[model samples]
Target: MPDMFCFQCEQTAGGTGCQGRAGVCGKKANTATLQDELTGALIGLARTAMNSTPTAETHKTVIEGLFTTITNVSFDDEAIECQIAKTEAAKQAMAPQCSSCASKCVRNDNYDMQNLWTDNEDIRSLKSLILFGIRGMAAYAYHALVLGYTDDEVNLFFYKALAAIGEELDADTLLALVMETGNVNLKCMELLDRANTETYGTPEPTKVTMNIEAGPFIVVSGHDLYDLHLLLEQTKGKGINIYTHGEMLPAHAYPALKAYPHLKGNFGTAWQNQQKEFDGLPAPVLFTTNCLMPVKQSYSDRIFTTEVVAYPEMVHIDEDKDFTPVINKALELGGYRELHPMTGINGGDTLTTGFARGTVLSVADKVIDAVKAGAIKHFFLVGGCDGARPGRNYYTDFVKQTPKDTIILTLACGKYRFNDLDLGEIGGLPRIMDMGQCNDAYSAIQVAIALAGAFECGVNELPLTLVLSWYEQKAVCILLSLLALGIKNIYLGPTLPAFVSPNILNVLVEKFGISPISTPEADLKKILG
Candidate 1:
């Protein structure tokens, strides 16, 4: 009879966890309960698979189940219920003997999320880290899997991590697992990087216009390139233009994808602005992954979702990838009449991307020379997800206040806040470099390691700072990976996670020097001083 509890995102109620009729992400209480049931069932399946050998199907189930519960991924109770059924079926097949056991030991059973939700504060915080971290990592893994890649270690760890969540482990034990989640996520991210680069050639630097061309068009959002590829192939020569939106903006940098003649330009800003950007647009928007906000009535008819993304009553494109319905919708809408001019949040008409690790490191000698010559004083990796919170403007102000002599590398939706601002260039490199999507944090990490190697110093010793904004689980896992690598002095905002207990927060501050962001002026002064 009471409302469900959820605070896994920055938009949680009042800077605390959301404990109300619906999540700030627009997830209803019934949907939240179904997601919890799906999670619990996945845990039960993991417990069963811990004793039995896991099949590829087992790993796939674990990945999809976790990904389904990620904030903003799914809002359909039926889809989550279907996942729960599949999880239960997998458990039954894996350990049929347990069902008939006379003893009621309950060795492997579904974990009531309420237990972890109501556990001791510290334990809850630690377990939440492992759970949320895996949920985020699962998204990356799912993407890679769709592209024909998977790591056995990463897959098995999902079972181990889920089982640990159901255990009454001590603080130290859970803490170790929490850190292990981060360490494993780094490997998972690496696997995804390889999958992406190998599938679509290493991204090259390219400029993307924000203007949407006239005529019928479909806007593709989210991070799945394979889906984009299929859609492009299907729509080729159909008089329909395709444009990237949200995290898909970087898809234009892929040599294979960019070659598509009709894959026009980007349509909208970040994912948070979709409702406003897509409203009454004479085009269909296809969501291939997370960061989908609740659809509004104004644009509901033009919305189509594929893969794990779902909303009640919206048309879903299945794995077959037949996008005819979407194409038809686009044709029906017929797009803008004249050449419709669209600008980014910064009022700029174009954005540049593809500054991934490969591209950046290719010009490493020039960058090092510039730094040595005092042409470039510092580097700031100011990137993460963008949210509806007003404090998120801090990222905009931080980049605006950064000295011209510094380079700001950004990724994910957060870059939308200032991607269009002309920060000028340093040594032929734009002062503000867009680094693909959030998973391209892999690219950023690679660049950092290379720079440290070039300077013969540790990453922390380099004249570089990481100021990140968190909104969802992917940010959680990425932060853990940084901490796991002993990278410190990171500034995080708009606020600390509500799930972090006070003692755990102290440990993070004392051990890692993690600091919540202050005013852009003060933080910039502290960093640049």
Candidate 2:
């Protein structure tokens, strides 16, 4: 007998499923059923918000509901149960209990995910775009919240998109909503960009060593700058060193952040590789957000989660935003005995970062001159998160195959695959430019738009092609932003998302000219040709 049943979209446990007595996370089949019900309930809540005026409470519930189902956050049935209750409460608040209706409306009706999974692939993919895009945007919004930043339009779209998914919508209608998801995500990213750069000065070119400093140190991961700042402040003068982990690696380039003396260096590569890297770390680690893999037994106690990122038994620091528990753990571990030299995957001791718009555009004249004089041939934005899947080799090989005359721009964790390579430079600009973290997709978009203006061409017409790798929701939102801007012909993959139905994939391929990446050799031939 099957233990459980779940095929939410194209990509589930496998092409088939992990229908066992329980999920790998130990979730019971009934809970999985309830979670699906909760999702449907949220969709209903979204519909109500769409057709009726919503209170502020409704908005908060919508954001949190979508945020919960993202890859790795809540594994607790109790938590999911609570969220479902909250959704119903919000629904009741929106319209109040209906007074004596002939047809009793089910406020807590559950959505049959199978309906979504079985729908025409194209429509499913469009809805997946709306769903996944909001999930990722919610993460961004949450980060902005820790730093005290929020936007009304960004919140409203979550309701609009979710409501559309539950309603009877056509392919064209859903596709338009998918693009709209991208449009609001752009505003969301802009809010975050302003929150970051304004709080931590514009990132300047800084050389960050991979080395871990001696004595007590703390490792900070995730996308929260406010938490990192708080830790830096708390750990100061405590004989503790702070090191960046995962997406936080780019923090070394920001002036205000880098100015902190105790902020030492980066501890590891990307998020996917954390289990292997954190196995026996001498210092305590803190996760501020997603991209957390299933924790291993060895380092489970040493790890802590803050904000929305929660794992069973891991110490979760709440909204006061206090990080004392993390600081204490770092001191307890006492780091390395002495400074140990470290390098990137390429064996380079120091990785150079901070090529956001300000830095790149500051050298705009030089870049333009280089392109004009034939010194620089093309630009390749090779970025996104790195993954454990075998198909990820395409990114490493694609970067290796690009022409020497091309300048490579990268962001997010995907660069972990090849950031160590010394691709040299065209003129004074390094061949590979690290444009901050994933949220810094704003930087990549800014750079592209600027280059297009400089060359007097549309972003798509410029001699630049985007080869993107997506692992989670953040990447999904960024891809939507690219499409919303009408930039066409993006090369996306290691693998297309399991959630995108074939028909939906076809629409993207037709409208945006999206190509699933093949062998680096073959794809490069097509891109450069």
Output the number of the lDDT-best candidate: 1
Query: Least accurate stretch of 10 residues (summed lDDT) in model 1?
Result: 99-108
Clashing pairs in 1: none
lDDT of 2: 0.80
Candidate 2 per-residue lDDT, tens place, 1-529, comes to: 2246654322346644447666544456766666677778888887667667886667777777777766656565666787899998888777675534567665434466668756776777788788888888888877776667878898888877777777679988888888899999999999999888888889898888788777998889887788899888888799998888878888888899999998888887877778888898888888877666677888887888876566668888887868888888877888899887776666777777899888999999999999999998889999987777667877888898898999999999899888888889888789999998898989889888898898888898888899998876778888999999998999987777777767777878899999988888998888878
- Misplaced by over 4 Å in model 1 are none
Candidate with best TM-score: 1
For model 1, how does the per-residue alpha-carbon lDDT over 264-330 read when each residue is reduced to its tens digit?
Answer: 8998898888888888889999999998889999999988999988999999999788999999999
Total clashes for model 2: 6
Model 1 has an lDDT value of 0.92
RMSD of each: 0.9, 2.7
Q: Quote the RMSD, in angstroms, for model 1.
A: 0.9
Give the Å error, residue 383, model 2. Answer: 0.5
Off by over 4 Å in 2: 1-12, 15-35, 55-57, 98-112
